[model samples]
Target: MLPEAEKLQFLKKTELFSELPETELKSICQIANEVAYPADTTLFEEGDEGDSLYLMVDGEVSIIKAGTEVLFFNEKGYCLGEIALIDNKPRSATVKTVKSTQFLRITRHDFYNAMAREPRIGSGMFRVLNDKIRRDLEIQMSAIRKEVAQEESMRLAAEVQQSLLPNQEISHPYVSSAGYCQPANSVGGDYYDYLSLPDNSIAIFLGDVMGHGYHSAMVAAMTKSCLQTQIPFDASVPEVMKAITRVIEGSRTFIYMTCCYLIIHPDNRFEFANAGHPQMLLYRGNNSEPLELESTFMPVGFARFCESEQYYSTEVEWHSGDLLVLYSDGITEACNPDAEMYGLERFKALISEKRHLSPMKIKTEILSDLRVYQQDESTTDDITLVVAKFL
Candidate 1:
């Protein structure tokens, strides 16, 4: 128990009773009860009826909501529960003692008597409550504005990413081709295109940037720009890869890309190259297992290859009735509700079953099967697939 003079001094330091005269402070202290609480004690839970206002004589307390801290109060002058007392509402947050604490507690009945006799205490409490509410409102508005700005930025980025993709369809006399690209989010790193060359040869390309999102989409666009100008119908696979590698290596941001590029001539000759991308499957009419286009070079941006370094390209005869499929890892790595990956074996088996169908039908069935396997789970990466079949 503090002396009367000491109690009056502490109340003078508190905002709620600071304007009151020493005689009034002393009178109020007579009705206030001194309470001691041990460390880690919960003073009150959020949403409980708040009938008492506590003035801290010594100790610290924190306000928490849903396990997150909202505010903290300490020091002899700090007062809590005043807002609920003034508004006649429940407590807004949980208050717990941080250490062994001593407080001067004034219940609703005692507080009302003090407020009626000493109007200064009531006026001071109203001012304090208004200030607290204003500060909390400001914080909430700032957070809401930040969220809105981020959503708008993503929407614009998705629009720009869609525009970067080539919209032209491929029409070749010897083969029919179709391409598909579906980003998991508004924008992603997956990219694919069918380029009809000046020499009547058709070029097919698909690449995935290291990760998904804004940075990945930017890198994908840069990769497409580099490949479009540097690769020609007769350009060697190694040469095209070197050009793309230089662009990635020169970028200020750390990035890498995996790609598969193929060129097919009207003479039934085809050339294929892969840079750490997923294997391309060639389904022959007679064989159950599809031929794999094994990756022979490192992923772009991994290392700077010297001009003398050799890059390997596979040459194959595009026989009639043969179906070729190019895809990204998004297909095989798609997760199910149970977190099971749609593995390579399942993908191969689907192709074997759907090989006899047209290119478009094969693409559709594979996507449908993937959706069925995934069920309610969301895909984490961009899904892109392209198919070409020799007539």
Candidate 2:
């Protein structure tokens, strides 16, 4: 048996009963009997009817379920057998002492006695436990809501981004064009657009922003709108790029765009300009070799001082069985599970083997090769490609 003064000291230190008055605490302590058990003794077995609670005064106890220890409790104020005290439920887990232990035991009868005398204290304890249960439920519900919102946002952004791209197939009197874009994630920053010039010349453009997600998607949208407003059929590629650079420079957010633009005329002549974009490939069926049209200047938004005529143009004869491929860096830089890059060599092999295939087939084959090589690895970059076949 514990002395009256020591029992009161224990109750005063416990947060749950600290608010109780000294007289009520003394009455509660009178019903709590001190017990001792040898080491490795089972205090309560699983599935046993629970009718009492235990407060450890010394030594340690382990709560075990299915022969596996789940929780360990030590220290003077640790309480156990809460299922009995809270709801009169069967013991959900077994408890055993790690060493010789002393505990203050309180039975269901004693608990009812205290509650009967101080109903307000009983209500306060129940309220605190109820609030904790509600908080856990609320946290789980909030996590589910956040997940659903992110998925919906991605779906909507992807639809908007797709609407900004050119149609699947475009046919003009002089040339036929087709392109494909597959974002590694739900949204992307790569964009491609084609416009028929008033002078019967066809203008084509492909650009990629620096990053992915909503911020990059928004930048791509703004870039397309800005280009449409600034460039006309008469405007040279250099002039159009300069206008785009000016717009991006004025914004506080840092963003850069790599672009390749080309204008094709009726006489099979081509004028091309590049800004830090991947080299455009031109495959001539007559000769087994492929021509690489390389980049000439830094990407857009890099230059503060704009040059009046910093563009280059090249003329090429368009005949039957000619293929031109323009693509984003995502294709060549793709990595497999082994960390090997799908580099220029693989690209050249695919093209060399499928040179005779149609524009759509070539596009399909390239993407198929990328997926096979990646082998279930998630794509880390946005994939975009454009193919123009001269017929």
Candidate 3:
């Protein structure tokens, strides 16, 4: 047992009694009881009525919640369960002794009666709670500010990504094209671009990074840069695919993209190199079922493992008024509340029905139809569509 003087010194160090007058302090020391418990003893449980305040004197205790240890304290003069003196609320967490421990315990009834006689101890508790609340608010406000800053950064990244896309529609005398992309987030991984090539040919490129967000968007940007550099001098289907493959293999992010590259020439002949991408569709002006532009190679990042010869091209014929559909899998994979996906066959039917419309109109109608079809699963993944019509 601590001597009377030593107990007074320890109680004075505690926040609840720190500002008490000497007379009130000695009064509390008289009422306070010394208690001891062995290790592994449970002092109280969550949801039990708060009835007593325990002032730490020695050893340690653990605060637990829902069977998980939340915190532990070993320092002298650190009070535990002090809130019981102020309120009758149930305990918020379980308390157990981690080792043989001693505490100066004060019952809520005793503390309240004592407070009526000497009010300073009561006011000091209010002061301690005020300081605690202010500190907690400061920490929460700092965290909120950090989150808002991160959101703004993503908004800026989305703007930069939007700028990287070509105008939604590109006009050419031989072939006209229109494109649309809906990112699942502020920034996304799907991207597409079309530019005129030699001999009135237009080089079309579409890619989908493995996932969405700033990192995936960065990889898409790098892939686009790789395509821009290669198309200016070469623009051939095989050469462009090689450039895209290099960018994916060299990326520090170690991610992959499903990609499609195609060249449309005045002769009505088109060459496509599919890099593990979903099938591209070509609707003949004849109104027959659309031709599926199947995958000719593995996806870009993974293609690094295979021979360069696997990165090759295939030829397909297109005629006047023929419509081409280049898209990411997000289109066919979108689901509704019922867990039903807007499927491939439905997409092909839409292309076949809308083939006669201008490429821009076809692009709009398809996107609008998808919006209706999504129902609730509208923005699960980035969606991209590029529609080209041979004039």
State each model's CA lDDT, in order: 0.83, 0.79, 0.83
lDDT of 1 by residue, 1-391 (tens): 9888888888888778888888898898898788989988999988999899898999998777655555566767677787788788888878899899999999988888888898888778877777778756754565466567878998999988887766755656788877788888889999987777777888888899888898899888888888778875346666777777888888887788889888898898899789899899998877889999878777877775434335667888888899999999999999998999999999999989988888889989999999999997988999999988987
Clashing pairs in 1: none
Ranking by TM-score: 3, 1, 2
Best by TM-score: 3
**For model 2, the run of ten residues with the poorest summed lDDT:** 131-140
Question: How close to the true structure is residue 166 of candidate 2, measured as C-alpha lDDT?
Answer: 81
After superposition, candidate 2 runs with Cα above 4 Å error: 1-129, 304-320
TM-score of each: 0.68, 0.66, 0.70
- What is the per-residue lDDT of model 2 for residues 281-375, given as tens digits with 9 covering 90 to 100? 88887565678888887887677545533655656677767888899999999999999999987897788688788778888899899989999
TM-score winner between candidates 1 and 2: 1
Report the candidate with higher TM-score, 1 versus 3: 3
Model 3 lDDT tens row, 1-391: 8898998888888888898877788989988999999999999988888889888899899877666565677978766676654667888668899999999999888888888987787777887677647644654565566567878999899998998799647677778888888899999999998777767787888999999888999998897788778888888887787777777888775788888888887787999888889998888877759888899777888855666544567888888888888999889999877878899999988878878888889988998898899865657899999998888
RMSD values, in order shown: 8.6, 13.1, 8.3
Candidate 2 lDDT score relative to the true structure: 0.79
Q: What local lDDT score does residue 72 receive in model 3, on the 0 to 100 scale?
A: 74
Q: Of the candidates numbered 1 and 2, which has the greater lDDT value?
A: 1
Ranked by lDDT, top first = 1, 3, 2
